[model samples]
Target: MFLDEHTAKQQIVAFAKSIFDRGLTSGASANMSVRIENAWVMTPTNTCFGFLNAEELSVVGLDGTLLKGLPPSKEFRLHKAMYDQRPNDRCIIHLHSTYATALSCISATDNSNVVPTFTPYLTMRLGPIAMVPYFAPGDDALAESVGKVAAKHAGIIMANHGPIVSAETVESCVYGMEELEESCKLALLLKNENANTLTAEQINFLLNKFKK
Candidate 1:
């Protein structure tokens, strides 16, 4: 599918509006983007979700030039690196929903910290969530660091930061992000109880059934 500049602008505005209505983020805590042909359409820096207009979205060339709108978000490297590697990724969402951000602030890979196999839908959407080491926000090093496993992850938790999801569409990306947050919420709720935990056998079955 060819993504025209006009459509890219609309998707950027619409995606921001949808997530804003869902209360996924507030202030300037999140950014959304889409790959349009070889370039990308992204939300501009310091913009509020509630007030985004199509004209305000930024057009960034694949080679990293700011082609239109206000300057892009500080998380430019994070978005660019994903599109540079994942040819099919059309939408990207980086959000800081309350519980997800809290969990990320304290997550370590040693936690066996996969987002859990608690829900079939979540499992199917975000296959494996990677845990990336902490870097100062908007740091180029953060984006390059994630390049190590870009071939495997759909959503990755930025240690002490938040979550980033890339998918074939905006809705799918949003759903995966929500699932990531929900999984974290579910884990907290069941941390004290041994109930509903996935058995090794069940996980093995799922692993076999959901091979991407």
Candidate 2:
């Protein structure tokens, strides 16, 4: 279900407002982009999600030209890297959500799948989340690291940064981000407890049954 540019812009605004209102992200720390036929409708740099105007969203060409509106986010390279790796993904959401950011600060035993599978929903909504080692914001290497893993993982957590998720639609991308945040919350909450995470067998079953 490819979206026209107008519809993509509207959806980005609506969902961004919802994400902002719920405190999923704050200030201008987050960015979102929707891939249209020849371009991407993206949140502008330094624009607050709560106050986004659909008309002000950047329309960027595949070659990174700003075709319309304000300049694309400074982290536009991150979005582009993911899109380059996953041709089927239509929307990309990057958020500095609280719990997920907190989780990102910690070292993971497995960088390939940093966030633990606390429940089935996280696995069903998002597959294993890869981890990118910390790099300065807007660093090209950060995008390079993401591109290396984006093909295998729809979700990613950047060390000392936050989560980036992509999906076939804006709604699915938002939902996956929410699930990642919530799963991080659960993981933090159970850090000291003898938490019962889903077994490998169960995870394989879910992957075979529901992975997209």
lDDT of 1: 0.79
* Top TM-score model: 2
The residue-by-residue lDDT of candidate 1 on 132-190, one tens digit each, is 88899888899997766665777788888888888888778888888888887886777
Locate the minimum summed-lDDT window of 10 residues in model 2: 113-122
lDDT of 2: 0.94
Q: Which residue pairs collide, candidate 1?
A: none
C-alpha TM-scores of all predictions: 0.91, 0.99
Give Cα distance to truth, residue 99, candidate 2, Å: 0.5
Flag regions of model 2 displaced more than 4 Å. Answer: none
Show how many residue pairs clash in every candidate, following the order shown: 0, 0
